[model samples]
Target: MRKTALFAALSVTGALLSGCGTAERLSRIGRAPDMAPIADPTRDPNYRPVSMPMPAPQDARNLSANSLWRPGSRTFLRDQRASAVGDIITILVSIRDQAELQNTSERSRENSESMGIPRILGLDSSYARFFPQGFDPSRMIEANSNNGSQGTGRIRRNEAVTMRVAGTVTQVLPNGNLVVTGRQQVRVNHEMRDMQLTGIIRPQDIASDNTVQHDRLAEARISYGGRGTVSDVQQPRYGQQILDAILPF
Candidate 1:
């Protein structure tokens, strides 16, 4: 009997351990993934840019002394713009919007239709004799309608993120546009905030200070998010969320 009890206890313990492992793995979801930057673009074992339609890369042209400015040329005299792969530049983030509208409308309509039977037709006196004082053949059909609608809508939103982060130029397109990507993570007191950006930018868009505005970027994919213990506590439990998704009210 003692041996059987020991066996049952061991089995329960094992089951509990297995459940804990699974719960730990699932709890990591929505938390920041292993926060590792790509070691190399081309040589990395798993570093492939998303497959999408992009401009074909153009071939370099031979330059002579008479050529004042050749594409992708790095001259010793002028300021450098992020035109080539592996170059870096800073991006400024800015955003804001607001609007309001109101509409008022009112309408009223009345319609009355009637037919009279004259004394010559020999019906007016007989109808009046049979009818009460409120009854009248001249106002046989009457309809009154009133309809009014008024609506007002207002919207206001203000969001701004002003920070600078150096981004590497990942690809240079044929037309001299640079594909830039950057990611930054800040961790403080168990909370981690991550910012990432990827976009195509023209060489001329980079100012002499080597910075470009976020609004100027084309095909920009910017994401600002976070993950931490605080964030996890703010979200519903996985079991509750699953029930909410699959269960009908």
Candidate 2:
């Protein structure tokens, strides 16, 4: 009976060892029932780089349209509405009176004469000549008379001319000409000036402020404004002649 019991114990121990070896082999082969699959992150097409785009900065002062024109504003002429080119505008400047002119003339004459310049006391006056686009003196003389005569030239009113004031009228000459007593002179030309007119469209003037939002996610609670300008240059009928008078002879 003792020999039979020993053989039976050995058989039971062998069976237990065999069962543990089978479990080890199954784990090595990845055939174990509870084994998890390996994760491959690179296999995902949705994977992206670590870097991302940041949100843009907000400008607080830029909120209002008038803010653009305020001193120290970020938006300059280039950014303003009136900043655009091709804008046309006009401006007018009136001449001052005779007493004021006399005072100015006296000061200038004193200054020039004191500086070792010639002191001439008289108004400078001259008749300005006006002709068509193409003027021929020979043709003009021939038109006056068949025989060339000094005082027989025909002056046509087709050319428009205007009297320009020059220097200070020191004295009235016997003939109605002004004795201009200075070096300065007046010029005749197309009067042109640039003027800027800015137009602003406030948020309230447009649709409701609530309709527009700051950020895509947030509601717009701030007021907004837009601005623009109109510009033009205006000239008189005889602008070209005016330019010529202003130029130094």
| Model 1 lDDT per residue over 1-249, tens place | 999999998678656645784576477766543565755444556545544465667676677777677654466555477767788799887754344455555555555555653444666777757776656666655566555555555555657676677788887765667888887888876678888887878887888778999988888888988877676678775556657877999
lDDT at 246, model 1: 73
lDDT of 2 by residue, 79-174 (tens): 221111222111111223232111111111111111221222531111114443544432332222122223223332332222221212223223
For residue 141, give model 1's deviation from the true position in Å: 1.1
Give me the overall lDDT of model 2.
0.28
Deviation from truth (RMSD, Å), model 1 = 9.0
User: Which candidate leads in TM-score?
Assistant: 1
